[model samples]
Target: MNEQPRNPDPEIGDAFYGFVASEPQLTWHDGTPRLYFKAGQEHYEYGPDGSRTKLPTTFHDVVAFRGAAVSGDETLSKLDWFVAHGRLEPNTNPNTGVETKEFIANRLGPDAARMNIEIGTPRRRSQMESPNRRQPARQVVFEPPEQDQPEHEQPTRAM
Candidate 1:
């Protein structure tokens, strides 16, 4: 088996912070659950006089698999703001040979503070589609891993 790094620089890993463009779609891919969504980021600038300006919004397709997909299906929506980190992947259409690009999220979640939201249970499909009585929404909150934070701001352990 051969293993090669797709991107040599870890700093260049795929990262995106933006608004979700649509409700996430959850489905099975190769028997592992997957979640897909589109996210849009609008560029802005502050002028010398403090005036704000907007630039064209950039959009990216984001896909989450496994545990990430499970969590996303519950809490993600078009109305939410999101942040994701993964890798840029390129694909070619088999029939036409046209190339397309996508970002597959290894870590993803809503920006609760930016969205002014309190944590709440995600409305999962399983609960919605089940013939039995619906279960109450389960609230879950996540904190970023220590390694993911800036070195200067990393939390310190008590002696």
Candidate 2:
């Protein structure tokens, strides 16, 4: 099978974040807050005497979500549009609604179609949604030498 060789560029990283919702408790429909982080970026503010104040630097994004009510869910669901054909979708039932946050992932590239998020993005769905109780144990396997080997074979390693 043909495959593109993996690029060794270490700068590549996820650019977008957030997830979808089923039934949100907020009044607004498009309330999802997508979050993103970049390196070496800073916030600039203009002071009174024509001086600019470049505060500390940290990864910032235009879609990153913030928590409300002091102590609630940190994940944002408003930005999780039912993305099809790489476009933002309108609010609707089953397809789109502000329920609880679902998943938060980062964009793969300029395509904005592919996303990668933390594995098992947790959801508050009932038992029917989540079934696995305990994770399975990890295991490794080893293969033996072929049967047609020489009788005087010393070991598994070939000289």
Candidate 3:
């Protein structure tokens, strides 16, 4: 089979940070799970005197599929601040033939800028321990591999 080489700097999608404008709905489309929500994105203009003027919030329709749909349904709610990275696709209404854009999110998460978050220590399971009841799957956290540092240099933490 012929395949094309992957682009090193491929275009992913645009990112938007906003508050949830409506309650998220989880539905199934053609046997695939889908999550739908509206995001209210606010804009601001800064004046020369450092004063900021708030602009009207723009509402956008956002959708996520598969694993993202399940996670979003569990964590997202109305009025919650979130960040979504996705591409806009034209969605036309069959009855009206009106074209509208929908944000198809590949990634969705809480906006850290507007909230505080704590990274919990990962729970480890013992080889001998057996669970009496079925446990919910734990969310996996990815940690980058530690890079080798010079003997004279020590790692520092940012405050």
Residue-level lDDT of model 2, residues 1-159, one tens digit each, is 988769766544333322332323332237654333221334679988999988765432122233331111222233232221121223233656643322222221111233332324432223123457576887888898767857695867778
Q: What is the lDDT of residue 15 in candidate 1?
A: 82
74-156 per-residue lDDT for model 3 (tens digits): 66678878888888899986899988899888887766567443223112122224666678889999999999878896779
Among all windows of 10 consecutive residues in model 1, the one with the lowest summed lDDT is 121-130
For all the candidates, what are their Cα RMSDs to the real structure? 15.7, 15.6, 12.9
True-structure lDDT of candidate 1: 0.79
What's the true lDDT of residue 144 in model 1?
78
Alpha-carbon TM-score of each model against the true structure: 0.61, 0.20, 0.65
Better of 1 and 2 by lDDT: 1
Collision pairs in model 1: 74-122
Write down the lDDT of every candidate, Cα atoms only.
Answer: 0.79, 0.34, 0.79
Quote the lDDT for 113 in model 1.
Answer: 62
Cα shift from native, residue 151, model 1 (Å): 56
Q: How do the residues 1-159 of candidate 1 rate in per-residue lDDT, one tens digit apiece?
A: 899989786555778788889789999978998999888888999899999999899887788999888887777788578778888899676899988887888788877668654456464343355457787899999997766546576578999
lDDT of residue 75 for candidate 3 = 66
